[model samples]
Every structure is written in structure tokens, then in C-alpha cells.
Target: MRITALAAALVLVVASAAPASAAAADGTYEYKLLAKAKPDECFNGIGVPYPAGPPCAEGQPKVNQAYVWGLTRVGTDIWFGTGTNNNCLTTGATLGATKPVLNADYVCEYAESQMVKNDPKIPPEIGDVRPPEVWVYDSRSQRNTDLSAQIDKRSTDDKYRRDHTIGLRAAGNFKDVVLLAGPTAEGYVNVFAFDARSHRYLGSTTYTGYGNVRTFLQYDNALYLGVGVGVNGGDGGAVLRWTGSLKSPFSFDVVASLPVQAADLSAYDGRIAATSWPAEGSVNAPEKMAGVWISPLLADGLPGLTTEDAAGWKQVWNARQYEPDKVTAATYGMGGVASYGGYLWWGSMHVPMKATKVHQKVYPQDTDEAKQAQVKGTQRATSIFRGKNLGTPDQKIELVYGAVALPVYDGVTKTWSNKTTNYTPLFGKSGFDNPYNNYTWRMVVTDGKLFVGTMDWSYVVQDIVSGGSQVAAPDPVGYGGDLWMFTDPEQKATAVNTTGMGNYLNYGIRNMIVDGTGGLYLGMANPMNLRTDLTDDVPEGGWELIHLTKSCK
Candidate 1:
């Protein structure tokens, strides 16, 4: 009887494992890892040994962790930009106040006191600076070319340096030119242009007015991008229309002005819509709250609108409309918006510990109750929201995955919010039943289905918050980011691949592009610099370009 029962358990185990590996074997989703960053690829010159001895400075062996920050496809060439050492950058920018000890494989260079002493003019909060690189891969010829040397050859005053242009975050094609943009350390935007046909670098430009940029959309014979206006991109936001000339690539006109930083932009129902980031400092009105906003009908079906068009824009929905507490509403920002299945679909984004840090600043965790309140205030995982006929009185919005009641900490009263969220989720709780899926990093529609990619924080759960206590790490059995597919709005999304394409170090799916055929190109976000042991079962972490090809059924 014991032997029979053991055989039955073995059969169950085989059945469970079959479906998990079926995607690769069944020819439905075959992933090919095309390119990856080398372990010792350094961006900046360092160390006193100069050219001969060591390539990098002491304690900075892992300073060049890069990611495919910007990706776009023109004709037969796929163009991508790499941003180096982002975790170190985030260490200074966000986590400097309460510097937490991350995993053993990662290091935060800017947090070191000696580094700050060397350059007292710059604070530790600004982070380490490293120049980004642009590359192109020809699908037809199967050749990859690094075009970063062109920018280096034309350097005049370090405008293209890491201090001026840190990383490329957005990429899109306008007319015959492919444009890539990134924010400077001083809070300004820099753009680089390339000739799409020749694959030649057409030089770069700096826009002093815009601080940060997110996504780009080409509609009605023109290209538009969402940008933030002031320091650290917190003051306000605007949507700028490209004038479509390589000679005047930097020239753009504001089509819509927003209350906060504009994030992802999408076109739906003959209009353009955008997600937003919460403004820095304080939130006051509904417009300032992070939410989805729609523009006026597209200037008579063309891109010739004036400032009058910007004025006609309206805030269709906001965080204030859903969250009962103002604090949670202000902290929540919308992420990854896309038009799918006759509706505008978007998800909420909560920067890990952003709310917790805010509450800590106000309440100081003086008592045990205040510390509990801080934990309660930490926002839940991302929730998907979709709306039809937005910006109209009769518009209907549905919650696809979210909590019925979102808890918030009121620092003023030093108590937790008793109110509940307005909408009940149709699918399930936020993050699709996994609380670690904090950011809806990328969303794309392909093959009559909607694909949603998430940033899973399970890998870093142990080091999320600072004060010496560690959160229990998630099980390593399922540690990678997630990709979900929705065939119908009424039905729950199916898991396409939950193991980050077989690399557990890949924490997020940063970018996705449809190949027009049955293939989809994915730009993976894996920034573990010190995990360079190639002999391991799963290879080292860095940026990787993966091609997912589906077999014709």
C-alpha cells in the first residue's frame, strides 16, 4: 500500500512539472536569449593604476550593472540603449536616508562616506554617474553594432557625459529619425537621434526645460512624448509633439500640461491618454493626484493643435476617486497604460517603501503603534484598472485586480484609515494574488491578447526597508518576475511565463516590442552586477534581449 501511494505521488509530481516546461517544448513560446551584458563592462574610467593594472576602483568591482533601458525597432534593426549601475544610482537617489544592506551580491557605491568626501559638491543622494550606450541589432544580417563611440568622438564639453545625460529611458521613431532620450543629473532632458535607414548617429540635443521623460507614441503622422518639467521631475508634466525634422529635433510644442509627471501614454477611442506620477512635496487637488488623464479629440484628426488643445484636456479618473484616504491616493501612481479590447487599461504603481518612508518622516515611529501604522500604510501590489468611454459622463471603469479596502496611515491622526476602496476587483487582489508584484512595468497587446509584465520584489524582500529588521524573503522556488496574458476582459489572465524567461535574477520585464510577425521582443531588467559566475546553473544577471517566437498553430 505504501509503494502504491508513493507511485501515485510521483505521478502527480510529473503532471505538475509537465505544464511548467510545456511552453518551451510545445513550440508555443520559444525564448532565445540573443544578447547579454558582459560581466566587466565598465562605463567610466576609474582607479589610479590607469590602463595597466585594475580596470575599476577598489570596492567598485561591480559598478557597471547595465540594463536595456530603451528599446525600439525600426525596419530590420532593433535599437536599444543600456543604462549602467542603476541600483547604485537608486541607492543614492532614494535609499540614502536610511541606507539598507542589500543582498550580498549587490553593493551601493554612492553610499560610502569616502566617495562623498572626494566630491563634496555633490551630495550622496545624487548617486554615481555613468555614461549610457546605444546599440543596434540587424535581424536580417544577424549583426550587432555598438554606436556609443560616435557620441564619444563628438564630445565637446561633456554634455553627453554621465553627469549631463545619465541613461536613456525612452525610445521611438519619428519620420526617418530614431530618437532616444534620458534625464541628466541636473534634472534636464537630453535626446540623441539616429538615421533609421543608414543606422548612423545623427548627433544629440539637450532640452533644458524638460527634466524627465517616460514613453513615446507616434500618432496621426507625428510623434509625442511625455515629460516632467522641474527638479527630479516632480513639479509638473507635459506632452510634447515632435516637429518631425532632424534639423530641429529638439523643438517640441506642449500639447497637454499635467499637474504631475506624465508616465506611459496610449491612444484609445480617437484620443490620447496618459498615466501620471504623483507630484513631489504635497498633493492638493484632484488634478494633482496621480491618475489617468485624456486629451481633447486630436486637433481635427491631425497634430496641428495649439495651446488651446492643451486647455481642453480633462482628468477622467484619479487615485482620489478610488482610495478613501488622501495619503494613499497621493502616494499611488498609475503605470503601464495601454489600449486593449475596446478599453483603456492601466495599473497602479507604488514605489516600494515610498509610502512607508513618508509615514516614517512624519510620525518618526516613536511608539509601537506608530510602527504598526507604518506597516499598514505600505501600499499593496499593483491593481489593474480599465475604462471605456473615458472623459465622458457615462464612462464606466472596472477594477480587474485590486483590494476591496486599501489601508492608509493618517500621520495627522496617527491612526489607520477605516475607509474602503471604491471598486471591488473582478479578477482578484492586487498583483494577481501575489503581493510582491509592485510595479506593472510594461504592458503590450499582441496576437489578439493583452500581455502584462510585472516587477516582482520577492528577490529583494529581505532588504526592502532599512531600520535593521529584515522582512522574510520569499521562497526561492519561484523567484523571478511575471508575465500574464489576458485573452478576454471578463476572464482572468493566464500566466505566460512566471520565471523571468528562466533567469531568476531578471527582476522585471522592462520593455516589449511586437515583431509584426508572431514574435515578440523582450528587454529584460536584471541588474545583479556581482552575480557574474557563468558556471552557475542560471547565468549571471545584467541586461538581456530575449526573442519569444510562437509557432503557427
Candidate 2:
């Protein structure tokens, strides 16, 4: 969707994920945007569509890529704030906000990422939502405020750890569209629901699902959260639910708990959809069912789970049996979530599953060229794969659910081609941030289309962009690191379109939120101040606040 000069005054949004078109922007990094936003683009329980890009407007560089993290959207306008201070940039020098971007522009400017000081040193099993109050590039109000405090006291509690920002979501009409963020601790995930009117925290609640809730979704008036429980013998992963009821004196209830060995997810429909890795693995080994799951969400008050069910949340939906294939074993959600048109969609890291020819002999991907050759007597299953059906039917066949069961993304060709020729964006690190193909961490669908970003991949880019990958900063950088645009109509990955928007936040790109005006906003790491690691420029360096607008002129 491009905005003409006349249209730039407001904001126009379009459907993406269709067979749109565009050329890869020149490799040289130049930030671009089309500023136009719709009214109900935020928290309306509806979505706006985005056409493929290549035609968005080009703009002057916006702040030269501050290491910003966590993006939050206020109304149609976008708000971005940085995270924790490095407290040690160079030679152990402390780095915190010296005076952040209050409100920068209608065009995309300001900085975000913040280096966290008291960031919890938790296990990799949980998700952290710290560095409260994702900043709004205050426009008319001017001077950014810690709006998060209105929602979380943690804003003052320096001990609180807030990492990335997911965008603003509608909780209910009366209340503000819920903006989701995380706090670090042993087993607590904070949800600071805000009131767009008062522009303050409506009510802040934390869930003790015993697991670290990764992402969230609103459906059927319920808040579904993806909580990950370590599989190394502890509680496995599960999806916890919360009803959007402000009253009733209830803490929070576990809606439908979907359990698995290692899982991370975002809520959609009755179930929480996510990406899994290996389709099949030893009963003990984890698979990548990063596929999709639609667990039951309290069917109209079907004896909703009680505290008694907490311990038994394990019985809710054994995530291990989630997708017959169990594809996402190790990667654990490294992908995002998307629910559109009654269908759930996700992408996997394609962590190969070792299969024998016997498995291939009995069952072929219908497009197995070698199998086809065997029919012509040109090849034999014995030569192709002669062994045993390593993966059971349920696991293997279940993995192949889509317009085309066989999914193949050729990083070399930069294309996603499936068995039946269905296509989608072929995004990767080569064209992406480097080190790894920009394997998107999460995805969001607006008006029948999809958008995605890489969490860890962006960290890789930060390494190179910062000068070199010398572990200059901490590895696997912060959230919402990089952003990648794509069209996922039929599910096969297709056109790979990185916008005129460069890596505004050299940090990890986290949640993707569409605003009331259809502008795309992200919650990421606090814009970084390269005090210790890169030793780049600041005033120019450090975290930031970034906004993306697409205009076709």
C-alpha cells in the first residue's frame, strides 16, 4: 500500500500477502516510509491488508538506526521506547537514557533500544517483557512519557526486566486495546492493559502459568497466552487463557492448556498457533510441531479450569501430540503466530528429520522426483531410501498439512516453491541480516495477508552493521531485531520484500502491531547505546523509537 502526497496527510492501508509485486530495494540501506493510518487499524478485532512492497516512499534516514527495542502503538499513531540501560558500554561504562526521543516526526525518526541493567539471568525457557512503557513518539503531546507506569509499577521498580514490546491490542471497547509486554522473573509474565483514553494503565496483571508465556492473542473474549515450560524434566509448554473481564475479582484462569515438550506461541481462535521444528523425533527427542494448534478454549464455560486444573494443565493439550509431525522440537517457537480467514499459518526452520528409504518407499512426498523416476524404472526405492518407516504415519503425514505438503525454500534462489507450485516469500539471511536466513521469529496477518520479522537474525545483522561480528555485544541480540515483508496467502512462502525501511532498530525486532491507521509498529529491545560493544556513534548510537509507513508514489 503506497500513500500519495495528498493521502500522506492521513494514512491508507492495503491488503498484503496476495500475489503482489516489487523489486528487491537496492542493497544499500536507506530507510523509507508511507505515512497514512486508518482509524480502526488498532484493536478493532479486524485487520488491514498490505500489498507487496517496492513502491513505498523513500524518506531521509530516520535516526540512522538506533538499537531500539519493543514497539507499542498508541491509537493510529505509533509509540516506541527503548529498554534497560547497558550500564556498561565501553570499558564497563554505564549506558542508560541520557534524554530519549520524546516525539520525533510524522515521518519515522527517534531512537529506542536501551541496555538493561537488572535484566534477569533466567533460563532460555522463558520470555521476558521488561523495560516498561514502550514510548510513543509523542507528536502533539510532545516529550515521551513513561506511559507504562500508568500500567505497571514496575516502571519504577528498577528490578523489573522489560525486554521487547508487542503492539497495542483491543481488550474490549470500553477498555483500551491491550498492549502486551513482558517482565523477567522465575515464572511471572506481566500484562499491562492500558486505557487509550486516560492514556494510562487500566489494570496490570501477571500470570503464573508456571511457564514463561511467550506471546498472546485475543479471541472469543479470552486472552490466550503461550507459556513455555522446559521439557528437560520440568513442566512442559502450555497455552494459558484469560477472559477479558475487568471485574469478577479473579486473578487469571488457565483457559485451555496445550502441553508439549518445548513450545512457544501466540494465541489465535480457540487454540494458540505456533511454529514447530522436526516433524518426527524419538519419543524422547523434541520435534518441530511449530505447525499449528487449535486447542479448546472453554467452550462457553465448560467447567473452565480451576486452580485444581493448574497442576493438571499438563492434560489440557499435550503439545507433544499437537501436530502429528512434531516438527518444531528444538527450535521451540523461533517463529511467530498468524491466524487469518479461519486458517492458521506458520513457518519452520526446516530442521531436517532423518528418514530411511523404507519410510520414503512406503510414502513419497507425491513430488519426490526420485520416486517418480522409480515409476519410470529410472530409479528404485532401494537406492533412494531403503530402511524403515522411521517416523510414524501420524507424525510424518501430519507434518504435511497445507496447499502443498512438501515445503521447500531455496535460499540460493530466494524463492519459496512447494510441490503444487504454490509460492510465497523466500526470506533469508543472505538477503536478510546474515549469519542465518532471516528465519522469521513471529508473524501477524492483517486483512487476509501476513507480515513477519526475525528475532535472532537481527542480532546477527547488528553484529555486521555495528562493524563486525566479534561478539561485540551479547550474542543472540534483543527482540524484534529485523523486519521482513512477505505475502503468505496460500501458506507457501513467496515474495521476499524488505521495505525501504532499513533495520531502524539494529536490535532484535520483537512483536508486530498494526495501528488504528494501519501503520506497522514493532516492540523491540531498548535502542542500544554502544557504550561497551560496538563503540560506534551515539547521539547517533544507542537504542531508539521507529515507525514504518508505506507510500506508493
Candidate 3:
């Protein structure tokens, strides 16, 4: 569906304004629901008509979950990628011999059925792959185009094929070219580039060495890439510099090697700072742990952007300094990082069920009751932190949303050992005091204000294994993901919308970007595919795109 600017503005929802204060901005945010994933079109294969018949075989369940996986912007065109039935794919990827519980949420049919239908000889490591898509929405024309359709017809260039792409995880723009990338069935990262102005396919390439790619940072008028080189990003990480022409659109040169996977990157105080993911064996070593690291000063020359300055990076803070248990701390992955008000701000994240895995490994549980206890004991919320004068003797760091003491697990004693967090939050507890806010998904600083997007697990806490049992949970504080804003770090955060912008099923904000106008674009994540009864109160599952404009009083 296409919505004109005038029509979109007519349906805008003006959110409640913050409390009056000297530091507060006297205004409310007005948002418009621009688009939603079409249930019939999103899951259809390339060149296939809407409502494409039934599954290949009966009794074999169809993967139904769909959501926006990646998003970026060029000019007035918003480009995003989509994936379907991801929960099913994840189940197949994780469980080999172990069978998962029979849950309505997901079924690992990809390995047993879906793969053979596509290719019997495909590698098991990438057997769950599906055909993902790239789409571009022109803000000016208010028309959405599926770029994947054009690629599918390019029979001459096999590089443009989308048959094997599981999902596009990241989108970026460099030198007037828009790039979309995701993992393929061959266990490699495949990237496709298109002309930003013409919207024509340029080329595509697969990086076999990098198993995972996260974010793309544009700093000092140059583009830098962050990726993981080992299986599932468990070995090490590297930062790459783009050095390609139109002929070789996928060319990149290594800039730095990290002890583990690099997740996000930010520019601060004339240097680059990065957040990391723990390696397979780096949980106990402070120097090799997951934390914040800073690079040497990037001058106008090629020193910092080349391999010559790889050794000049320094680890300023680590997980060991925050959480007491090394294994649990390692399970706390790092999320969005950015520079705001002369300080570098970052936060920790809990990959769903990760802490439970760590707990079971540390203290071998023999029964279902013991396993449930481990899950309950390891449940944790994310914490936010900020630092100043990093890498200097006078450097200082403080918790922005953390506790003085947190529960920890001891492997040797096999008991819960609570430990001091070492610093108190300047604002309040982690997840803004809500334990279910597991991910600080994305953050952006605009107009002297910081906007934080979070993944709240409140809606599905009962459906998933997160609660550790089949017991009921209290009705959630509110359904959907949350959006919070901070006019000043010294003041409390104002809730922009805790009900996922009126859609109780929109679980999180996966991607957010400023429009360079007085507006922001949000890509929402909603994977509740089983709830297809639109006649009811619940909204249809999949993804939604919203445009929010700030209106001052």
C-alpha cells in the first residue's frame, strides 16, 4: 500500500509530551504508520504469485514468521531486507541430534524437509536457508519496489541470485551504491550492490572467510565494515575498509584484527571505539574479554585505515570489570554504542536463552527441574555504561543503568554467588528497571537528544522457554517494544511509546535512522506469524515501517 505525504500526515499520532523542565524540549513526537509487510507477498518466492499454494508436502509445517531484517537509506529511498520463519531456521541451526520440544512457536522442519525439497546435496551447516528479499521505498513517490524481482530475472549473473540467502542482516551505502548482504547456503557472506540513483543491479560477491557481518560505520567520509571470521562469530573479528570501484564492488582491505567478534563501532574524540562479542575461550581473560576498545587517532593519512595500525588498538574496559561471574559476563553481549555529550555510551545485551546455556554448562543439570532452576537463576537484563577520557590515566567510567550488586553463578562451588557491580547507575537500574528489556537494540543521537530502542520480551515471555516453565506470567506492563528518549543524561528518560506504537505485537525496533529532516524512520520487528486472525484484536505479524516527526509546542 502506498501512502501519500498528505495522507500519512493526516493519520499521525502525536505522542504525549514530557514533563516541563528547563532541560526538556517543549514538544511531542508525531508518528505515521507508513507501511507493513503484506502477509501474502512477503513469504512468496521470487516470480511466484501471491498466496502461493500449500507446502510442498502435507503434515510438514510451513515456516511462517517474517520481519524486517536489515534497513538503510539513500536520498529519499528507504531500503530494507526481509526474512521469513527465522525461528524455525534458528532451531535447525542449533539442534543437531537433540530434538526441540513440540512448541507452536517453531518447528525445525527445514533440515528434515525444506532442504531436500531445494537441494539434497546442500551442506547441513547451511541447509535451513531460504529466499530473502530486498525492497526499496521511495519517500517522494510513496511507492515500494521489490528489488529482488529484478535480481531474480538476471539469469546471466549468478551472483545476483537470492535463492540461497537466508536473510539480509545489514544494509549500507558507499559512493552512491546501495549494498545489501546476508549469509548464504554455502556458509559465506554474500553481498549485492545496486546503483543508488538508477536502482540497477551492479554486482554481488561472497566473502567465504567471514561467517557473520554486523554493522557498517561511515566516519571521516569513509566506509568501514565489521565482521566475524569464524563459525557463528565465535572465533575472532576484523574491521575492514572498502576500497572498490564499480567493477569490483565487493573489495575490502583488513584494517584491524580483534580478539573476538566486533559488534558495533562509533567515532569519539577523534578516535574510533568498538564493542565486542566473546570468543569461544576468552571468557576468563580480561585482556581478551568482551568489552569496549579504542583505536589510535585516525589521521588524514592511511595509517589507521590500513593494516599498519592494527596493533595500536587498546582495550579500555571489559566484562570482568562489571559482572562477577566470567561466564555470565561473557554471555552478556554488547549492543549499540555511540558518542553523546562528550562521552562514549554503550550497553550490554542478553541474546535470548544465552544465559541459560551458560548456566547449564557451568553447573551440569541432570533433570528438568534442575534445568528450569538454572534458567530462572541466569535470567538477566542489559546494563548501560558510559566512559570519558578513555585510554588515559585519568579515564573515568560510570553505569548509566545498572545495579550495585547483581546475582552471579559459580562453576566451582556450583551455587549462586551474587557479586558487586563495582559502579552505581547515574540514572537508574538496567532496562530502565524492567527485567524483560533484554536488548538495547539501537541508539541514535539527533537534535541534541538521544533516542534508545529496546527489545522487550514481555509479550512472549509465556510462549517461549524464557520463563523456564509452563507457568503463567503476569499480564505484561504493556505489549510491544519500547522507545525512550533522553533530553539530558542528568535527567530521567521519557517514555516515547511503551506499547510498540499501538501494535502490541511489534516486539522491537530493529533498525532506526535519521531522515536528515526533523524526522526519523523506524523498522519494527514482529515475528508472531501464527497469529494471522486479523479479525481479532492482535495485529498481523511481520514487520512495520513508521516515520516519526518532531513537533514542537
Candidate 4:
């Protein structure tokens, strides 16, 4: 009898193991390659494509633009925004010129000036701005339409003479209209309206304060905008509420302000939650580090009763309180935030290229201290946190996803404590076990599941190599942005798709939206014009729009 029971147990073990292995082999989701943008697509209806050579020299047959940064769904059609390869404009120019320009401060400006001088058709006021293109894909008809010209016409600013609009930063459906925010030169954020029913372009409103509008959310019948002060000078960041009729679309009210840049804003549990960039300095900094704040719920249960002051908001989480001993200071600027699974989910931002010493004095990149700082910055994995009962004072917050267990530092004691405890990483340590995938660009909840999109810097490392930088290459596993879905609350994260949805040039999944019909759309970020060297499949590097759906067994 004992032998027979043992034999049955062995049989059960084998049967269970076989199914688990097969499931692993089958993968959780099937990926379909949807569409690819070409180099000529950037020039479509805009301006003539620059002749091959010199500054505009081709990496492939045709230099491709990168990023389908903006994505939104209206009815059955999906609208995506594509960004130009600003790197092709100048060797030093970066996307949105985010980096601090040291040597030639205006390389992109200089290149634009030269392009205007050469091209007869191109106006000097517009310069050589290769504005982002807008495309609409009709899922019902399976057709695509280029709406770049219509969007451009509505955003034209004769005062600035800079008609070239960058990629759409945020998009949403509000009151039967699709609102799109596009930023141009000199801290101008242009908001455009489109009739979703007729797919027609409406008028646009241009705001002067914020350089870029990063995120948008609709609550309490009002559209809230999160604006960032990029390279342009401003009084940090502000949250603006749009409360106007169709006839007067430009009316806005400033609701809140922060000392640093406002990274993102989201509506959660009848209140608005916001995150900001880190302030300067280390131990005794004048301004506080990045933090999560919730506005007091008004009588209408909306988040706009107070102005931009301490008394108007309640602080929830601060990076300094969670800073690890490995780094001098924690600059935990929050990224995407959303309400999911009975909790508010938020992600951290840790871009190594943007990492710098936050305490004491600025350290030079060549010094050992600076190099260690860079490693420490990269080691600061993007963490995912969840808070339950967000608005109430009894709210609880916990780290749901992260890899490293950094030792907590005690300011008064001046010692490292809790080295072995409380530093639990839900995800395995080391950049979620993929070093290059550090920044969580966006997060969204759909069909009762949480999906996270990341920005992998492995391609940026390769771009550095192609541009003759001394930094070593990153690991192969870290090449592309990864999409992770949290379905079973108890199970590990399921990787839906990883190969940048078939475009290897895609380094970041900047935006994602649900199609309302059981489908998810992803926007790719491939800034440095990448082409597939192995095959001629895509000779020019361009951004791609990818759609994901569950496969039938």
C-alpha cells in the first residue's frame, strides 16, 4: 500500500511539472507587429526632407524619427504622436534638449538656423524644426490618416514664429472632444481640440508659463493639467485646471505650485495625487526632495479647494525618509501614478544619465566620487509603491515592487540601520534583474490588471557607442523596454511582450492606452534614429505603434 501511494504521488508531481514547463514555453501573451513609421513619414505634408549628407547624414537609407510618444483612443480610432530624431539635427542635441548644454549651448538652434537659410520653401521663423507627426488608425476600418497638417495649422503662433510643434505630450477625451497638448520653443504649451465625432480639428489655446505639459487627468468634470518647466525658465511647476466651454477653450486656473518640476498628477480616491522633482542640495537643502502629496477633498469631492501653499495639501511620502545609505541623498521623483486593485500605484524615476549628487556640491563626472554617484544613482532601482485608503489619515503605504534592499540611514544617529530588514524587494534586485530597465515611464490599469511600461537605457548605451563615447555597452537582456502585467495578485509579474513590440530601435514605452474593446495600444520611444542592420526590413529608424491582445488557446 505504501509503495502504491508513493507511485501515485510521483505521478502527480510529474504531471504538474509538465504543465508548468509547457506554460512557461507558451508565454503569457502573443505579440503582433502593428505598424512602423518611416523617415518620409516625418516629412509628409510638412517640409521637404533634407538632402542626404553632412549634419543630416543618413544612418540608414533614410534617417528615421523616433517615438510614438502620444497615444489616445476616440471611439474606434487610435491617435498616436510621432517625434523627430532631434539627434540628427546636431551631434549634441537630445530629445527635447533635456540635458544641460555646456559647450555650444544651442547646437539644435544653430542647426535650425542653418536649415532655414538653405531651404527656400522653409521659412526662417519656423527654422529647421522637424515637428512631430500625428496619425490616426481606425481599428474599425483598419486605415490610417495623417493629421499632421491639421494639427499644425491649429497650433501656429505668429508671435513666436515657431510653427513646428513637437510630439503630443498628453492626450485624453474630455466632453466629447479629444484634447492634445503640444509644446513648441520658448516654454509654449499649445492645447488643441479635435471633435471626436467628426474627427475634425477645432481651435487651439497656447499657454506661456510651462515649457512642457507632461500628464493630464479628468476629474470633477474638469481637465487637470501637469506642466513641467523644462529648459525654459519659470517658477518651477504648476497644476492648471481647465474649466471653460467650447467657445472659450483657453480659460485656465492655476490650482497648485511646487518648488521643483511637477512630474505627474492623477486622480485617486476622490482626491488628486501629485509628485514632483527633487530639490537641490543634500542634508540641509533649502527645498525638500521629491514627495507625494494629496489635496484636501472639497465639498464636491474634487481636489481643488486650496491654492499652492502648505496649508492646502497633506504630505504623504518623502524620498528623504526612504533614502538608502549607499547614496548621499535620494531624489525619488515619482513617475506614472494610477489607481489600481484597491490601492494607488506609483513608480519612481531613476535615469542614470540624469543622476547627479543632490547634497553638498556638484561632483564632476570624471571624478571617482561622481562615478560612484552615477552607479549609486543607477542602483536606485525604480520602485513601485501602493497605498491603501489614500485620502484618510489612516492610509498605509508599502513597497510592492523593487529589487534592492537599501539600508536605511538615520540622520540623528549618523549610522546605517535596518540593513537586513524592511528592505524587501518584491521584484528581484538589479534593475528588476535587467540593469538597463530602470525608469518606469508610464503605468495604466485595464481589464482589472496593472500594466507597467519602462524606459530601457541599453539602446542609449549603444547610441553612445555609435557616437564614439567611452562608456561600455550594456547587457543584451537590457536592450528594449519591457511590458509587465500584474494579473494574479499572488503570482509574479507576467511579461506580456519585451522586444519593443517588434521594433528593436524602440527603447522606451512612453505611453499606453486602452482601446475600450479589450485591446491595449503602446507608443514606442526610439529617439536616436535606429535601423535594423541585420536585415533591410526597416532601413530607416522610426517609431512604431503596437497593439496587444490576448490570444485564443
Give the alpha-carbon lDDT of every model: 0.71, 0.34, 0.69, 0.58
Indicate whether candidate 2 or candidate 3 has the larger lDDT: 3
lDDT of candidate 2? Answer: 0.34
- How far in Å is the alpha carbon of 295 misplaced in model 2? 1.3
Q: Model 1, range 153-259, lDDT digits (tens) per residue?
A: 77764344534566888999977888889887777888888888887777787777788888888777778899998766867999988875766656678888887
Q: What is the lDDT of residue 78 in candidate 2?
A: 50
Tens digit of per-residue lDDT, candidate 4, span 67-132 = 776678877888776666544332222222322211110112333444455644443433434566
User: Cα RMSD to native, each candidate?
Assistant: 7.6, 16.1, 8.6, 11.1
Best by lDDT: 1
TM-score of each: 0.87, 0.51, 0.85, 0.76
Q: For each candidate, how many residue pairs have backbone atoms clashing (under 3 Å)?
A: 0, 134, 1, 2
Candidates sorted by lDDT, best first: 1, 3, 4, 2
Ten residues in sequence with the least summed lDDT for candidate 1: 16-25
1-553: candidate 3 lDDT, tens digit per residue: 1113212211221111111111222347867788876543222332222243343221322334366777788989999887665555554564232232333333334434445455764554434455777889999998888888777776645434477667887788878878887766656677888888899988677787886776777788777777777655656888887877566788888887887777788888988888887777767677667788888788836644677757777889987798876777777778778888888988887865666665666677765554554555566677888899999998999899877887676666666656898888888877776666778877888878788878876565545423223333234345567777888877878878776766766778777888888568888877665445446544666678888788754
What does candidate 2's lDDT look like per residue over 1-553, in tens digits?
1112112211111111111222353332123322211111111010112122222232212211232333444454454433333211100111121222211111111122212223334322211122334444544454555554544464543224333322221122223444454433444445555555555555555445443444555454544455554422134455555545434212345543434422335444543344332222333443223334444443434543333444333221122332122221222223455654444445433211112122233334344343322222110000000011112242211221212222233334533343331222233212132322233545666534566554333332233233333432242222224455434443433323332133333334444666544445554433332221123322122344444444443
Q: What is the lDDT of candidate 1?
A: 0.71
Native-to-model Cα distance after best TM-score fit, residue 531 in candidate 3, in Å = 2.5
